[model samples]
Target: MTAAVAQSLSSLLQRTTIEDHEAVLKSCNAVLAKSKSDTRAQHVKAVALLKLDRYEDCLRVFEDAGDALKQSAGLEYAYALYKCGKPEDAITIVSQLGAGRGAQHLEAQAAYRAERFHRTAEIYEDLREEHVSMSNEENDLRINSWAADAQLQWKGQSDSVHHTKATRDDLEAFETAFNAACLSLAKGEFGQAEILLTRAKELCRTSEDLTAEDKEAELVPILVQQLYVLNKQGKQAEAQALLEEISISNISDLSTKKITQNNVILTQQTSPNPYVLYKALNASPTPVDNDKLFEFQNNILVGNTHTADLLVRKYDGIIRSTSKALSQSPCPSVSPSVNLLAVYNAAAHAQGQTGALALKAICPLLERRPKDLGLALTAVQLYASTGNTTAAIHTLEAFLRGLEESISEDDKDARFNPGLLSVLVSLYKREGRTAHIRSELAKAAAHWRDRSEPCISLLQAAGTSLLHSSDRADLEMAGTLFRSLHQRQADDLFATAGYVASQAVINYASIENQVDQLPSVSDLVADVDVDALEQTGILPSPGSVAAAAAVIAGARGKRPAAPGDEKSAKRVRKSRLPKEYDPAKTPDPERWLPLRDRSTYRPKGRKGKQRAADRMQGGVVSEKVEEVATTVKSSGGGGGGGQKKKKKGKR
Candidate 1:
């Protein structure tokens, strides 16, 4: 053992100890390059190559190392060969490693990786049975973990295997099912994954030593996967329902009496399942017990649900105790999250049961903490559902004002603002405040044009309000707004077109009084189809008397007479006559003269008096009366003989 030889031996031992194969390989290669005849260095280099995942290089290095320790290095060579897809060669080498448990395990892993699942299972079973009496429990657990991992991998790789058997109580079975479910999920086989996960959950349910953390880790994955599966199946309502159930179960179990208070807070702080908190807050059997809260928080954090119902009862008791404790020595200051959590729980429970008083009780708490976005949102929702638009709007405005002041330019709050904007629009609509509604819509559109929900909703609100507005300018503004929005949101075409048509009607009305100032009827008609007008039931039918009157009145620029006017009254009565009755064809107009004297026709009412005074003020009225008498005498020819006989009698 000279200095250089001793250094070489030490270097070889250090290379073998290095976990990183590439580093080991590099170091071993350096040693091999310096000592070409060192067979031991060559063997170490081959093992390094094997670990580095370069199987062919490992084989070359092993062959060049010579046959001095081939039996001992054979297992490593076989594994490297197996990984390189040379399973036949791996099998031949592994078969010669003798009947040791380590050899069997290696062979099993190789068979599992090669897709020979049944053979791998047999090997693992034999290893387990042989190692049952072994004192190394940790080794057994590791072997079981490996076998389960392999089984899960196998199940995932092949879907043709029937999985009807109930999962065994062994941890290995659950591990296999979990891994298989995960693999199936990754491959978009949600149905198979869900079944496997459900089985895994059933297996873990009865495990006595399962800790809160373990339960949490175990169940969270399954629930998340279940959610994914249910959502993919288009069973959204069912998924939501399942989420609710899981939340309730988690809260009940975690809040058991046995859970420590510190553990409760820790669990509440770190738990990924917020739904449990949500459920606990909303659970029935009012006035949440402290014990129940404690248990709920614990179980939720831990993922235990074996005795959820009992835990829920215990939770009720704990809540009562905690409330008494808090009352005895009230903390003057609590974290905002804690207060908000309390309010959230209360509000959620109130909302679930339609407990209006309970909801109102939490409002002050929520109002005081407007910074809590979740609390604010839930409050708005609950108020809105109850038709308390005022309260809802107030809560929403508080949130918006807070956000506007606090949210920064780089914050992600911009993505969430549109939803709040939509809620504002809904509130205004519910209040029938068209002006506020339009303003909110415009603001929303400016901010949320890319978000289809808010954009479409705002456009609809604006278009509807504009359609019903009397102002031409407003209608035109609405039309322009709708047209711009329509390009982006084609689904709102019907509403957009209605707004445009409304603007057209307003334009038509404006021009009605100044026919010369407006486009001609034909031109206007060309721009707007009469059929559309008819379909909308806004314009009268073509050629109808009403239509004629509209056109005549429109053309003359004369306002139609009021109904109380004598001439308008007469026209209205005459207009009601059948088409066959022609006033122009009357033989003697005076033959149907009034039986009473002209004094009888004297004005009686204020309107009639005004008409007579105007007639008297105008000399044409007296001349028209004389003309009517002279025309009547000319029509009476028999009057001439009566006049001649009267003249003879006088002579």
Candidate 2:
């Protein structure tokens, strides 16, 4: 029997088709029928039936499983019974199993769903005690979150006061208060909602466990709802005071998170407007919506504008006053569409006040969807308002520079139109960049030549400046530009002025040099010459005339001597030969003669002659001669044939 049951279970597990769901159920039922005591198989059948939405069949299986388990199946049985619409039966089952807080929470949820407010409150009170007793932080938080939800759902049904400390982990508590406040507002219980929302705000403020970011997230939606309720109740002053008290830091954090979590929470909730409005309100201080907020902020960026403050007050009043309506008896789930609309409205409101604020408000929306041209335009305009011309220009250029097809002409016209163009032109003018101004003017002229006002104004100003300037270059350039303009728009006033200036300049140039010379000439040559100076001549006597002619002839005939020739040409050259020449005592051609018989030259002195005689007597005539020759050569002259022969041999 057990083998058959196991096989059937395995087969059931393998079944996939919806048609097979019944077969799977039948197999499990067969196993249970044969054993009539297999709780596990019965439980399996119950789960299978539940999957098929056979709630009645599943409930019967769970009951039989419970009987077989004899107390083992506690929470599972209770859940199955609850799903079968037997909350009381589920509650009894949980009690029998001693399921504790989980059971109570489930029972409370069932009671709340059934509109048994008193029972729900009672269960929540017990659950709250269970949460306080538990030491595990995660478990405590989980149970407390449910407890808060229950208490909020049944706020007037029980007399139990909340005992949990307003610690940072009181997120669930704040959520509870937020819901209760919303509910009270829905039920026309404005005062009660106000109290709960105010408590929620206080808890958010004091909770140490709540991060600044988390606190902000908790505060904004509650505050916005409270503001709506207050507004609906005609408590303008109160609403304004509450809004004024809201920390901008908190708002900023909430706004940032909302952008990322957009539509997720609101899509599941009943009232998204309050939450979205909260996000927008928080984002109001950013620099993005300055232009959008022009009317509200009075075009001032630094100081607070009374008008904007008042607008904020009015909006806050409206929000607080409507909070009650949003939080009616049974809280409705928030729809995605309502959330989206609320975001749009908030962004619009922020834009209406200041472009900077509007940008911050819309950034989240844009992040969710970059193709929203309205948001793109708003961002661009805000950038312009903040004097971010480069950013604005780039944004426009990006839109114009297509990654795909260009934006249609009609769409461009619809978007940029005349008003936007005017704004762009004005911005360019304000920046005082001539090139940008010119480009923008030209663009405008090309697109809207029929209007002509802006183009005409720019042209007139440019022409006037050119005409009045002292720089002729400037005038010339302007004239050329004017001619171009005239070609585009004939007979334009500025163009006409340019043409007249050009002509006047030409005429002035022609007469200018002559006119300027007359004064200087008058200063230097006053009363001087008429025809007398022109006919003046110099006459000379006959002698003077002849002298002048002679001088001229002399100058023509004379030529300058070459360099170094004047001194050297007058110097006489002496003959190189000595005064005495003796051919009989001829020296060899390659040799030099001694200074003997020459002026101041005698045959060598007595001592030299004695030495010569001794050398000859020794039969050393050649030697004596050679010695003399060496002496002479050492003195820088050839000695004679003997010396010559010796030199030749050495070489």
Give the Cα lDDT of each candidate.
0.56, 0.53
Highest-lDDT candidate: 1
**Per-residue lDDT of candidate 1, residues 1-651 (tens digit):** 454964666465665567877776677667666667665666677777766657777777666666664665787777766766566677778898788766676776666555466576566566666645446644454444444443544344332232333245333456566666755665567787788778778766656669866776567545655665776776766665655434433433333312322223323334555555444543433223212332223334333321232234344433344344334532221223233333334433343345377566557756665555555666777787888889888877766666656546422243235445666777888888778766665555555545544445555656666666677766776766666665764555455455446556766563343334334558756778766665444546555775666656655676566557767553457667767876678644454576333444665789776557656754455566678789788868765654444345654
List, in order, the clash count of every candidate structure. 21, 49
TM-score of 1: 0.30
Count backbone overlaps in model 1. 21
Reference-based TM-score of each model: 0.30, 0.25
Residue 295 of model 1 has an lDDT of 22
List where candidate 1 sits over 4 angstroms from the true fold.
Answer: 1-354, 384-389, 397-416, 427-436, 447-468, 479-651
Over the stretch 1-651, how does candidate 2's per-residue lDDT look in tens digits?
Answer: 787866675565556454566777887767766676666666666667767867676666655555655365666666766766566677677667655666676776556444455566566565655545545644444444444443443343222334332344443466656655655564567777788788888877888888877876667776666766776677866766766645434444433333222222222234535544444334443433111221112122212222233334555543343233323422111222222233334443464566567667755654553433444556676788888887776765554343113355544333334444455556566667556545444444445334433345454445544555556665665565565666766646546556556546656664343343233546668787644543342222353754455445445674334456654354444565456755478754534555552344434688876665654545545566679888767767444544544345654
- lDDT score for candidate 2 against the true structure: 0.53
| Candidate 2: segments with Cα more than 4 A from true spot | 1-37, 47-57, 63-74, 99-101, 111-158, 163-167, 172-174, 180-651
Candidate 1 RMSD to the real structure: 24.7
